[model samples]
Target: MKTFKLLSPFVLLLILIVSCSSVSEPESAVNELQVSNSLTEVEVDSIASTLSLFPNGTQFSIAFISDTAVSFYGAHRIDDDLKNTDNHDRVFEIGSISKVLTSTLLAHAIHDSIIREDQTVRSALDIEMAGDPEFTFLQLANHTSGLPRLPGGYTLNFLWNMNNPYKNFDAQELKTYLKDDLIMPRDPGETHRYSNLGAGLLGLFLSELENSSYENLLQKKIFEPMDMSRSTTDREVIKDYLVTGLTKRGSSAKNWDMADLAGAGGVLSTAEDLSRFIQANFNPDDPVLSLQRDSTFQVNDSMDIAMGWFILNRDSGDRWYWHNGGTGGYRSSVVMDPEQKTGVVVLSNISAGHSEADKIDRLSFDLMKMHFAN
Candidate 1:
């Protein structure tokens, strides 16, 4: 069993000593955390006050990142007190947001000529099994692969364990499930159907193509170039910096283990690293990011699914690309306008079951909209 390192008290003192601050400001977010000068003090207080409403032990890292400016905020609750946290580099599980990164890997593959978007899973895998699944790489990235949300017979396994549901289901097991129990519910790309199984399969195919594990591929292809040095899918590599996720009751929750389904929801990252990723989206010259952002499968008049993002068409003829994710003990939301070269990232240690979890997404969307308005 993995044991999470607790850093609350000692780390707090260390931050105090390092920052050269004597005491925490009372009752609000003006403590150890740093906010950039790009935002006015009034704007900072409003963001802080709104984030303070969550339950105790909830740590949040948020950023307003753009080509021209970067603003950040971090706060956490301890008992009845809300203290500003270091916004620069505290790692937390990003949940299904990993799908966005996984899809970027696919785009990277396409950029490298290792594969094409139209390639079917059957041909890619060299599997001649019956039923002949026709899901393609493009469909997997956009969640229209006609695959179920999860593999059959495993959704309810969380009844047995929740925090780390995928702990035992590894790659070999997934292969067995694909061969023995897999069934396509609809024809590939017939319609949009969000599927963790499909994304995981896409990750597996990418890994197989490179003869590498998913984590290794992410490092070589995505994280390193993007300078997301602290983000990773392997939990053990981040155990020291990993914040112990909190349950709804304000108690510690076990971290998740993705096993073979790491692609579905497994990466741990910090606000600083994630902001850099948003900056990369501002770069129109990067072929991989360009491809990921441009190839959209229209879901409706108001929305479209890109390689790993949802494009929300605003009434004002502008659009925002966004995605949100949650796991047993964490929730994340990110929204960005590449045209404006601005985005917001919200990461919290509060569980998805927490009553106030919706605030994370609300804050992200509202901040993005507000930036565009200004």
Candidate 2:
């Protein structure tokens, strides 16, 4: 009986070991996809199913990439009369994502010894201002500038005729606003507030410093070097692939001309091109959009606002750097995990439907955990 009891315990131990091994073997054998080709059919299906939970008429293109690999998915409502052509290369206006590009260009300018972050805005531009002379370029780029979200005295007529009210305001007008009637929203650098006007002003300052058009500078410094062939500040380059812009709530789509605010929300891009850019950001050796610094700027504890990238901290303790864009009818997002060297870029033509960008962002994090969690 004693021998039998000992034998039974040993048998049970062996069985448990075998069972655990059996359970874990497949998971161990299942390789996690790299940045180059991480999203498989199963992954894509999962993402599509999650996205379908949103409303109809919504369109989105997503790309996931790791250090050396990439995978993508493109989806839209079937009943919506929209067609996906060159879906990978289809150019859509990336709204705030332009800020990321702009910030990258500014960083390049600093690398080339063109401008310094601590330099005052007055040093870069000859514009007059009514606010304090203490406002610096860093303040403007980081949204620490006390400048209002929009320049003072802007009228609806400006928006109607200009399509973008701030676009038509020239350096002379900006000077007037500063010199005659600028109002400080808050003390400079006291808090973080997003200001489209502040970013636009930085673009204007760069243009003035270079003594060239913003479009020309962006092409020569960023687009050409990065091989962003389809990315363009010029409307002419993307005119062919331009999807009509839509209102946030209405059916009628309008063409938003960035003639005035071109620097802030002007550049048009595709998922394929943006993915390449994001990869370059992760690995700066590519000679495209490189990260010159070891660390980017963090906004308190919530997000890291790098030169052009925003880092989001997940509940699972994972860090993701991302940015979203929305023009009239176009919406897009770019998310990346520098640690795993994995990232995702999503673009959409219709803006009124769902927060697909945010959804894709969370999904990217979840997928990373699913495939890579140890």
Candidate 3:
């Protein structure tokens, strides 16, 4: 979760603009851009202006969702290094942002009476554990499970394939690590250290509870229900609509395959699909979404961890729920203010490891902050 004191919107925007580093100048890129004609000139100008901040070969998509209107603006630096129209349906790997979906799956399990939020991993998986590790599903989703970011020997396993690190670590390997190499460095539910391993394990546990694959559960529980047709854990399914990812050094990169670790960072989705999911977060009538959005762990005065969302406390008392994603070649961000019914999602083919990757996060936050500024 991103942490900072809320300064006045004007001052904050000024600081963001001044302090931010930029992507190196793209190779002979021109200023040509495409804005959605549906947006008013001011809206188009305001939204499209940010496209200039991205890298040379960037395909940037922005979706602004509000109570009164929804607007999507997309642009790509084409073969000639001139900007042109992109599409909101173009899919990108939304890295740890997949944790939000994983957490929501946990919320759904509890909602359906399949498991209690406090159910232990050992109880769920029926495993005997060492070191008295008794972390609950809630702890896993909220990043307080004391699980390491990666499983034992994961570094050596993924060392050979940095671009597709989690591809080879299938369910059996994860199971083997859990049984033979499990270790807990911190007591469960005591602290909030981010843990990809914990989130992935929760996804695996849900598979045990539902007797289905994590990919199937997501389709059944989320994407299918929300009509996110372009969203899936299967990269093959999205290959046609998928945007090619770029490495930090601005070279072509491979899309990551999470295999069994799909819960941690496997989901791939588009702006149009994600807007539906974000809109659901604002629906008070939806019990599962309501449960997912509730605060489960207080990370600090400024931030609260919800099921799959991080609640950023604003000075105005309304909260902004957000999550950002990064894979080898792609970066994504989603943020919303339920009170004002406004939010932003930014999906870029730029590598999150890129020096300017935080620009995506800042762009989303700055756009969302503008809504509250009113």
Candidate 4:
């Protein structure tokens, strides 16, 4: 969808049009994509070489991990500003990757018996829906909930403040939209259409069910348990360590505040912590974790919907469950093979155009393909 095209390109552009600074010289950085035949890195140098090409100096962190081992890399710096370099610990807005975490929360609620899989939107929240009343929580989690990608009134605010459209879209406004402006356009569970409103509303409903804030619920259920100490939904927490994202023209780009839509694309994280999050998905003790990856709906021949992940059928039937996120200036990606217990996490400060951002996404898949090929 064009909405996805505009927002979900997570990280560096592959094309040469944008100029960025290299954090370190190629020779000094780990420029190799291949580590071995079974888990070789492909075009790693090519990826590393483009590091400096980001006009605002890209700050990125990547990790490749399997059941047996892990490899990590980080480049944190401002373009052409050697004196102002940071490290992997610096935080970046993770954009929509927050969805995966929200889904994880949904899984936890199901696991804890706080919410039922059969619960419908009309019963869960204050929404006055005009469509199928039987639209279940399962449908919402898998994005089969017939809701539009955005609330009906979102377009005007988006046009008025492209940089920070959601800044004014707080909890009260979201409730207003749900009660007054919602109109179901498709039959629930008919097809897979991504909906930020649906996902964010799910978070809100879950939060109310738990009698706590979304951030607090996540902290108790996932972040603290997994030791993702640096991750947070509150912008104030990561403010000191946040990287400054840049625009196409190399000007400072505005960071977004998601207001009520925080569940959709509002969280800050680091690569190291995300790697741990992915690794935890393979832990057998975590039954709820697997629920997030369980197939919920079919999207197409190559893709399916799992709680919040896009399940791609790749490499002779291996499933690549992943999600990507982007806001005004930042983009992020996370992909993993639950079967292989292998995954990659990339976070960048620049939101290059779609083609470049897509290249960054492809590079992650390439990393996995190398492993599967062997």
Candidate 5:
């Protein structure tokens, strides 16, 4: 139990960006289904059945979309007493799904020749690692940068204030940590090890390259072009659009502020906005669309890491490039099947319990399966 406690926070962080992918479109594509198709009774039942297991008063929404069709469902509250099952457009912190957007910004950087896919961190930032290993932007984005999952002193901060571990972490603090405290868990580029610090650094470095804040870069390059009106990294904007986050014990929880680490996990968005982003992923003409799919590191036969997405290369040749996220009181997921031009977005404003990620993952995968398997 002591060990579990120490690891749970990391598990929460890991839950933030779970995804799958493929190199090319699947050999067999999904037939474009009609958008007007309503959720069948069985589908609704499946969602309810899953919700019944989580007693933590969840307010969740799911949006499943294909090339031509879309479907939505909401269990505005999971606890028995608070069955306010309305489908209002509520925004939740998207956790590390923000990484995908950060990486998309990197994609744009590559597209605009602002940066190269293989640009080194030392060359880009003029920083030194412990061993002076050459780490590339690709390594940082793909989690092979040898950086730990969190920064060196993150555990202490997390323990000091579990509610908002990143509240005080800023750019200068991060640079200080990088210079004196960072230690490579493995050789840079040796293997994939999910690192929030690496992703955060990638966002910072990209923003530096463009002479803008990560938030502004994403807003101008992604949110505006994608027309994601409700997506933003501002605490003020998030507060205005925010849904109340509930813990497993039914107590209100504080919203996360990513500060300088906004690139790592500082996004607040609605299901509708995320659905729009997913839909945009299908358009081949989108400049950075293909960049999201480009493989950065091969994890194994079962998975490959893309810029900010994970590619699950299945034996059947189907690919689901996806990512999931979790914060103190919110859980979110985004899954995309590039070949089928279909995807799913799930956002929830309640959390806790070690199984939070599994619950959301099961739901997201089931929705994706319903589209691809059927």
Candidate 6:
């Protein structure tokens, strides 16, 4: 729910213009019907090639849906001899994107009357606060909890083991940090500053409150109902199906295991399953996922972070909710235009290699504009 620090208003505006430009080109009245007919025959490969420009050695998959149909593209690495048979079902670690899922579970808990959005962190987790006691679940979900980006001792351990600094932290360590050494970067709810620690702690608290593991809670409330059969927290479940996540150079693959902080960077899913999730998000009436839109926390005067999803206002006055994820070798993104009844899900086995996630998000927007402009 934290606003991406790198996105400036001007940058977002530019991105919007570039993404939607094709939709606004004027068609001659004489040839309008002909142009529209030709547009439907546009090649998917052309779009795929445009997406390929951003990532290096990127093996990506995309799934998209509208009111009546679903489509898939680019299952390159997923089917090759480079990986095993279950590779198609292998769950790639979705990094920060896990935050969205964690946030959703928390929201569902709140909606179920199991927890309160305004509940103080201390009360929810039953621990002494080392910093601000006024912080609430909403603040944590929105990344305004003022908690440092990482635990206090993370840097000390990370200096020696950058690949697995967080691997050493457990619930006991987090509790100790909270009681003995935590500090807020600023006043809670002051501004948007992303904190993995904040989101991680939130997940811990939610799991404790529900009297169930975060993994189980998500399965019951989100995944199972949506029929995301291939999504799982157990690494072994997708072990044989796993795709090797490639580094930018395509030299080799790196696997990241965020043991205790699994809520922050755990869970693997396939493009097909993710597409279903995206569809449910856009059309909440599906009986699988329910989205409640409340303007409780506003971001940038117009947009809001509802539960774990982001609400963005388009130039045409339409709003969309979306999120993205990345880990060591994988990147993923989901976006939905609720008013237009359209959505997209993109997953890749390469990290930042070709900017695959961003390209898919842009292309989805372009496609949605074309679908809805009429």
List the candidate 1 regions with Cα displacement exceeding 4 Å.
1-37, 40-53, 128-130
lDDT for each residue of candidate 4 in 1-374, tens digit (9 for 90 to 100): 11111111122211111111111121211222233222222434434544444654666666665544445555544435312132456788888888888888888888878778778756766666444355777787889988888888566767677687677677787877766677877878888889988888777778877789999988888788766778898878888988887665556788888887888888899876786677677554557887778898888899988999999987488888988888778777889987776788777777744336666676677666664454
- For each of the candidates, the C-alpha root-mean-square deviation to the true structure, in angstroms, is 8.6, 13.1, 10.4, 9.3, 8.0, 10.7
- Give the per-residue lDDT digits (tens) of candidate 2, residues 1-374: 11111112112111000000111122221123233233344554555555454444555666655544555555555443222323666677788788877877677777677877678877766777765556777677677777777666564554565334444566666666678988887887676677777877778778888888888887877676556778887777678876555454435445555554566777888777776666555543432244432234567777766565666777778777777776657667667776666666767765523344456456655655554454
Model 1, C-alpha of 279: deviation from truth (Å)? 0.3
What tens-digit string does per-residue lDDT give for candidate 1 at 156-197? 886578867887778788888877888888888899989988
Model 3, 1-374: lDDT tens digits are 22212222222121000011101121111112222114343343344455444455777777776544455667665442424454678888889889999988888889889888788877877755566598999998889999888886666766577788888778788877777888887899889988889898888888977899998999888887777888998888878998889887668888888888889999999887787677666556567777888899999999999887889998879899999999889888999987666778889888877887887787788767664355
Best by lDDT: 1
Pairs of colliding residues, candidate 1: none
- Assess each prediction's global lDDT (C-alpha) against the native: 0.75, 0.61, 0.75, 0.70, 0.73, 0.61
Backbone collision count in every prediction? 0, 14, 0, 15, 11, 7
The TM-score values for the models, in the order shown, are 0.87, 0.77, 0.85, 0.83, 0.87, 0.77
Q: What is the Å distance of residue 42 in model 1 from its true position? A: 6.3
Off by over 4 Å in 6: 1-47, 54-57, 75-90, 153-165, 283-293, 353-374
Report the candidate with higher lDDT, 3 versus 4: 3
